[model samples]
Target: MMEEDDDVTQGVLLRCLSLYSRGGGCKVGATTSDEFGEIVGKSYKPVCGAQDTSVDCFSYGVEKFRKKNNKKKNFQLQEPNHNNNEMHVFLPDDILEMCLMRLPLTSLMNSRLVCKKWRSLTTTTRFMQMRRDGYYPSPWLFLFGTVKDGFCSRDIHAFDVSFNKWHKIEAEVLKGRFSFSVTSVHDNIYLVGGCSILGKMDRNSSKTHRGVLVFSPMTKSWHKVASMKHARSKPVLGVYKVNSNHLTIKSQHNNFFRTRQRIGGVSDVYEDPHRLSVRRVSRTSFEDQKSKQSKVNKSVKDCRRFLIIAAGGFGSWDEPLDSCEIYDSSSNKWTEIQQLPVDFGVVCSAVVCNGIFYVYSESNKLAAYDIGLGYWARVQTTPPPPQVHEYTPRLVSCDDRQLFMVSVSWCEGDGEIGRRNKAVRKLWELDFEYLTWNEVCVHPDAPMDWNSVFVADKNLIFGVEMFKIFGQVLEFLTMCDVSDPKMNWVHVSKNQVAREMDVSSCVMKSMAVVHL
Candidate 1:
């Protein structure tokens, strides 16, 4: 009887394996011994058991096969017995990795604690590359907020696109910082040019620094890189590829300069279009001299890959600056570039696409800077929708080699002729070749007050809204797939932490999307 029971359990286990191996096409009762052998590529004998019985051999082991009656016997699977060595089944590492890759990111992180092998397997660079290449995980949206205390909160929230869930990330490095610009390069988040306040009680100790902080979602750690030469606050930041041949100092000259003369007791170089010009100092400051000398002396030490471009921001004296700088990853140095056109009001939004740096100013004017030619051009496209505020328009680059602009406008209420009652949001695509703008779609269901919006993987668009209700601030996330013709906006859930904490005094700072 014991031997019969063991034979029945073994046959059931083999049948379960055959079902998985055949992708669930093999029927239990219909699969004869010869057919089962062909499915598993192994010879096995069929034991007498109930035809309707099913077992999940992957999760739980077979303890015993019970006999129910004289004519018909029922087979049952029970909890795994650790002491029963004969029932243990081992899968190949490759198969185990395939299963692990299918799990959600949060579950995959928890799976690392299962055993040393799993922990090691998931941490491997090859495994991460494989999972990323396979597109098993969706891009994650990261949201940052600042409280009334003038400091960024340490607790950041990330939204999982695949599971529509929120996960808390404790970014202790961002604590006590404010006014920093956040951007991502190659899936790594960069916090650049912010003021660091040391003591909560002492507001006079606030100091602006040029430090750059990098946060890696994969390792969940923070590290500092070489600081910029000139400290800036809320600077325009973007990434562009710098060609080796374009590194000559002559290219840094004012190509748009029509004439150079003294204006208002300061040397200035004037441009023809829009009367845009940059002020040139008669006597250079120490930093200005060093910048000029570096421009002349600095040689291309290695093949340049990509550069981090930082432009127009408030300088240390609380005055608006038109100076620009670029950070070369190959040399870990920040070199001064051509200054932004004078009187180009505060840079509200910036993006890099097709080797060009595009900046939208507070005056509702769009300008493009060609990295290769080392010059700037005012983009004279169709005017944006009426009354679109500077911060309301967001520039996003898509996978189709297209530039998209998202902006929000206020519409008058139906009851009142002039009173604005509703907010309307629309998307526009840019024809880069012809320098034209075309309307794409209108998102009617999006939140009226969107604090931040960003694109992920060049295909998905995420919009984040935060508002105070019942003295508690809650964050809501919504997403839309740009590839779809409908471009329907799907609402993700509100943040779980926001529900628990009273963040009414907090305001959204920035948002980034990363794949982990």
Candidate 2:
């Protein structure tokens, strides 16, 4: 559910009456019914006798009865009060379901087990009114991974934050697919490339599967859609959500509502007025501003293409690469962008925080990429003096307001395997805005060897894997409140996820998170 309201005292005052009476309880001794708006948390007040006080009387009676009932732990025959008129009343199943659906997502999920009716209401379309009212949440990350041990030749893992768990998705992949890459658009995570079932496994092979699959947890189903333009198993993919009107302005100064693109054709310009929180896409957004004196061209009206940038993979971290590409959802064309910064060794877990992309490197260095302006800049701060590289650095996004690094750190490095006294610090956080790093300390009682983790939902979680392999995980995710500068790293031990490359978890296997 949404966070608690500002006015803690004003809560939705629900009424409960005896099942026989079919009336509800109320707080004040009101003569008539009233609409309950606010949500209160603490103790309530008792109103004295007014017109019909049955509601309040019922409320008081139920509370006392419940408290007393909770005290009886042993099973024994108890005398029933035939005259007790304080039992809960049942409202029409549908109306009450609507009232329950209005609760926060968290509350609704927990309440599902209270009764069979509650469970059905929470999971059904009739009870899904919360989603339409914008009371539901934005789509979440789904990390992909393989279940069987071997070369990890499977593609069916996705993490759903709404369910607070991971899902193993079914896929139609080439036999021994081995590797794949993923990207996100709207609520769907696209599975793009992998070894084509009947093809060769040669280097950066064209044997990559060309199909794309999308999974939506709300409906809990998988659907295959169009394929990418070319066969690419490990290509980097980035998920960009832009408000067309606001994006057309090219500056964050404008006060426009956030817009989520409706699933557009791979070549079509994506727009959805129905999904916008507020404001509408005006004529200015679709026009090409060729000149102040000329009317905008009309070709855009005929066909619009939304861009999905894809870059980097399968070569030297120092490779002078510049063929950045965008998947045109409108035309189904995977158009390549010309001059992407080439010096940085881009990795999948890399993130654009505070306007710059923080990419960790094998050189034990942190590289920053300017996502909005397209430039590669090294984090000016010096790398931790010892210079470790074996273990992976999990990038936890801090208060991800605009995707700039609030902190960056890692666990274990490729410390000499046969050497003596090998000790690698597991985590660090660098506030990019401040150019500072603080090593986070794990709870003394918790596990120290963290394999992977990602930030989500204001909390952090760490995952597990045997041996030294990074386990071929596509994304690491968890919710964490990791932004405060004063927060102690000793308490910051964290991870949000791990999913296969084909089904993105974080960044929906965001390009930076995919072929890093």
Worst 10-residue lDDT window, candidate 2: 507-516
- Candidate 1 segments exceeding 4 Å error: 1-102, 148-151, 199-205, 241-305, 412-421, 445-451, 499-508
Which residue pairs in candidate 1 have backbone atoms (N, alpha carbon, C) closer than 3 angstroms, thus clashing?
A: none
Taking the tens digit of each residue's C-alpha lDDT, what string does model 2 give over 320-433? 233444455655555433333345454544543433345554455565434444333455454453433444455544334323222223334448576554344334556433
Q: What is residue 347's positional error in candidate 2, in angstroms?
A: 3.3
> For residues 173-233, could you state the per-residue lDDT of candidate 1 as single tens digits?
7777766777776557888887766555233566777899888776577898789877887
Lowest lDDT 10-residue stretch of candidate 1:
32-41
